[model samples]
Target chain A: MATAVNFKSEESQAELIQLVSFNLDREEYGVYVLKVREIIRMSNVTRVPNTPYYVEGVINLRGKVIPIISLRKKFSLSEKENDKQTRIIVMDVDGELMGFIVDSVSEVIRVSAGEIQPPPSVVNGGVDQEYLSGVINRADRLLVLLDLERVFSQSERESLINSSL
Target chain B: MAILCEDEELLEGFLAETSELLEKLDDDLVALEKAPEEIELLNGIFRSIHTVKGASSFLGFDLLVKITHKTEDVLNRLRKDELKVTPEIMDVVLEAVDHIKLLVNDIRNGEIVERELDEIINKLIPYISDAFRESAVLHMESAGTSEREKEVPASPVQTELETEAAAPAQERPRIEAAPAPSPQPPKPNSSKTVARGEELSDNTTVRIDVKRLDDLMNQVGEIVLERNRILQMNQDYLARENTANFGEEFSKLAKRIDFVTSELQMQVLKIRMIPVEKVFKKFPRIVRNLSRDLGKEVDLEINGEETELDRSVVDEIGDPLIHLIRNALDHGVEDPEERVAAGKPRTGKVVLSATHEGNNIIISIKDDGKGIDPEKLARKALDKGLVTEDQIAGMSGKEILDLIFLPGFSTKEKATDVSGRGVGMDVVKTNIRKLNGIIEIRSEVGKGSEFILKLPLTLAIIQSLLVDVENEVYSIPLAAVLETLKVDTSSFHVVGGQEVLKLRDSVLPLLRLQKLFGVQGSETSLNQSYVVIIGVAEKRMGLIVSRLLGQQEVAIKSLGKYLADAPGIAGSTILGDGRVALIVDPAGIIEMEESGVTGAWAA
Candidate 1:
């Protein structure tokens, strides 16, 4: 029990990383705690004209207007209806705030850096390896760590092309 | 010597005060050149330099002190009538002032680079009177000796403190030497002199950081949004409630809040308003220098310098305005001999004026010289293959003149460094369009050409006409909206595969927003739809939408870098019920229209 509590507090350790995990199409994804600003329930996003299909448009985050991206559309997964479980994970990437729509937010999970295995050459569910930082195996599920800088910076349309190929 | 002032606040204050003085000096020096014997102007110039010298000396910036001191002595001699103001003398003085500006910027940036101060200092010394030069040397030596002897080398701050105390005492002898009835030297603590006849107007204004004003504007935007929400809620409340007294009191309070919010927004916007003269200030000097360089006798007449615009607009207009004025001087103006042979005055006139027209500011640069010849422009465009002969044949005179603004178009046989290599006018047009400004050219061959720029007052907030297209709302800036009409679809005609609607005498080209944006929805009504006519420069287009959602005052917010350059969307603004609505870029849509990319209009 003492060891378990220490593992949770080990986030302050140099090699341990804390991530805010969320669900997208039954797949668990984790982004660094530092990058995740806040999670908001799905709200009305104004549709932008003449943008990529995956660009969900923009939403008013407080007084600021920030762009929203649909992770499902980005991964080429079938579109699902946004219900109570739909949440927008707002992340600060390169000083810009962008919100990503996911199925639901799970919890803040702490993991040892060694526990994260490098992503394999191929991954399931149409997600590109370029966007995956690593994969961690839990007792009953797998948590895929996402490199948001790559996921948001690299154009989704280009990634879609790579995935299709 | 390296500057080592520990107090960041004092250094910042000195930088602010001195930079403001330097800007005014640029205008004053130009005016002094035109009227060399204006004593009040001469005194103001002298006082500005003295204040700079005093402040820098306090901050222990030895290099700035040396430059401003020598320049101050020259200005003192000019004011005392010991030295005459000639082009040669003004050139050296302006050079010194420019160097001072550079040094001040260096200190502000926190890294002092080495400058060749000896060259400019040597040039300024020749303009100083012999007696003042001798006394100035004596004063410098004494001040230098006292500083070395009294202050320890370890404590630079103490030395700066002593100098700050001694700065005014040092100025007294210099002012006393100028004899009676000259402008009194400013007090020790106050480093700035009252500029000319203007009364000492301190404490009436505060020097605010622009970022703070931007924050306040954002807060006001939020307030405006909240006010809108309240108004909507009150309407719903009044409609749903049967309690008359409760509803009346709630509405009275809402009305009061609404009025207060509008006033607050206006006041905040007013704080960001600066006179266009901030940009117009540099022109006289530029004209003087460029006209002399070009050997063309030109007179620049400036009017409506007091017309105010947003500070953001003021900042961006400086470069474009300079290019336009230079174009007028270089290409539009004729040489003295040419003008005389053409039966015109030897001196060409370039009138630069600014005035408020409704919600827009109209700035025109009108030159009385060799006006643009449209036939020549057309021929050139054809040769360059920018436009074909058939296109030119169909264009009017004004449209042909606008061909100059097309990219890669230049009328000059050879590019000159003055007006830049051919890329100026298009870039100018693009920049103006970015501000939602319209640039129009009106010219008569051999008479003159006038380039009129109509710019919105502020980029932050605008009165936009909101329209709904397939359940998605968009805003069109009312400044660009000519009028909205409910037109019958059956009356529309397809001419040459392009949709057109004949409204009165003009055949207005129509573009459906739903089709343009690829909006997937059925038409609201097949019988009739709303057409919003928008005019950008000379080209007019009608935008068809499902419903007209009246007008709104919207605060524009950027869609971040990822979605920054979406083709037809300028930006997004949050609406009354916290929904984001995109602001349509009419200019961008027009570009799409010319490219034939947006699909044909649908009934």
Candidate 2:
């Protein structure tokens, strides 16, 4: 029977978790800090046949082929016309190493865990919420948390594996 | 380092929820294909998309949210009965799902994909009418939809009149008239209702990370090891502690521990269970695309998409299935004119089906078109020097079919866009072999061909028959072992300068484990000789071993980078005694035997 007052008092000093944020188009998104394996500049990617449209191709990382996906195309973002400020974030999901292309990475920011709120029913003029975890409000900007695991299920990941092979 | 403090709990929750939604989306989409008019299914699809859209939007994944929203709009119309579920419409929705899959992948990579949704949106445009768009605003406000019912009433009156007038003339006319007014409302309405019904059903589902499940399996394996130690300790204690009723107590404790450990092991294995529909869903589009590209009329049919398999096995089986489907479409199916000339149906039928056979899952891709011509395969094999004239003469039809899986072998005179790249079937064999599965092809000229793939329920744990070659132990997957026999050395005879063992009536080439693995052993007596009969790619041989141990369930551990490429060793496993025993790759060993390289063990 605890009311909103009880929660407010408990939430007075909110817990903040630092996240490395990046931008795609004009919006900023944050991924779990530990999920990221590395950040590197663009590299040559070999095209794999019969893959989904958003998969840019696969890159050879020390002889191991890792699929590279364009975050812009994946999220249905407007295709970037230029290569300026583009970066690839490499991450390991379910024991597979995959790379994601982003516009540019911003600074790591610490926002109170309590400050993060469940995604609203609608956002950015009615954008969908399949890829989002939650939204964290910073001083003047908002960081959208991403659910990486949901981003690729076992089947989708298998497609990447098949194309790579 | 401060960034490391970011709470993963919330993110994990999102992952779990979204993944569950995606899985539901996948299941409903597959079901939708079977029962296209099921309003409840349409509703289920609508909710899945809506939920995904809502979640992505909240997470600030504008790209994901936006695309899902567009797809949701199309589904919303479907659920409302404004849009009809035509194959074309299903194609668009499936493609949208593929796009969503790509978006999810992109999100996982921590990238924002911004692309024009116009292509997908354009695909949805023709389905929507001005009236539907006018009512879309009202539908949005109601959320639950008096607006849907409004469109339905108006359309139903006109549709009923059209149906009454057109029903006497032709079935196509009524279907065409019903869908023509506005395709938008039915799509969303169907999905929405279906989703609501599914939500109301008392089916409980839990989301799990596959990696975590794999870790749990590994931990259970360690516990089994610890249990073995405990059992041994208990036996020793029982002998030392000469108290009465010791036997009863020790036996009960051992049985209980065994039961608990086995249950725990089974529970962990179940966590990795995934339906075969995950692999089945992509085939419809593939079949459609291939049929169009090949200029052949094919009716691609699928059955038993609900079959469950381990995640790892499912991951490995997709490529082989694709190759089989491609091969069937390209080589098995004849052209329309040829079919008509043969007095058969002009439209070829390719049926992909899965069913459980005993403990194994059998997936068969059958085609009702031109079957494999054994003579043609034999001629090609001879032309390619894959087999000699004598070999071809002695070969059976099944043997000829097996020749197609040989690397760089293609019987097609002219390479087409669909196939004949000479890379697919061999890859199918290799991949299937990697999963410890077997592929068999059956065909007759002028009839159809069927490629059957027999796969284990899971790849993580395998029942292996432990055998001793000299002093070292090796595991042979029970799936590959046909029979074990104790051969008398006197029954061996030399044929073509190779030792062969006569079992029953057939002569099997004898490959001695000691000589094969370079183990120094003294000559053994005839009565003591053991032979393990194994089959690979339709080639059967007898593996002569020093001793035969009983079968046991073994958890596979990859040999990692240092030893992965090592010949003869498929992977390693820890026995109950905690000793690492290498699992033998029967296919690799068979390849070695076929290539006239019998000295693999000597190396």
Model 1 Cα lDDT, one tens digit per residue, B1-603: 345667655665565566667777887898899899799889878777777776776667777877876787678677768788998898888888888888876765566777767678767766766744554445444554553333223223234534554456345433423233233223344333332222111222234445546667776776777678677766767688645566676667678777767767777777678789878978888898899899999888999998988888987787779889999999899999999999999999999999999889999999998999988889989998999988898777777998988889988878888874778897787778778788889988898999999999999999999999988899999988989999789978988778899888777788989988878898565889899999775568899999999999999999887777787789889899999899999888887787676754332
**TM-score for each of the candidates:** 0.84, 0.62
Estimate, for each residue in B1-603, the C-alpha lDDT of model 2 and write its tens digit.
011214344333334345446645655675686688788778767756766665554455555654676577677677777777776877787777767766665554344456455577567555666664545444445533342244334333233432343223222222322222321111111111112211211112334555555667776776777678567767778687645666776677678677667777777777767678778876776787688788888888889988877887887888889988998988889899999999999999999999988557899999988899888888888888978999887766677788999899987898887778888888888888777677888887889999999888988788888998777678888888889988678888888767898878567887876666555468566566888998764567888888998898888766442234444557767666545667788887777777776743333
Clashes of each: 0, 66
DockQ of 1: 0.48
Best by DockQ: 1
How does model 2 score on DockQ?
Answer: 0.02
Give me the candidate number with maximum TM-score: 1
List-wise, what DockQ does each model earn? 0.48, 0.02
Best candidate (score: lDDT): 1
Give the residue spans of candidate 2 off by over 4 A.
A1-165, B1-44, B74-94, B116-248, B503-507, B525-528, B599-603
lDDT by residue for model 2 (A1-165), tens? 112122224556475566779988889888766678888888765433234567775555554456677888877878885386788888876567778899999877776667767777777622247667678776788778776666676565556434322
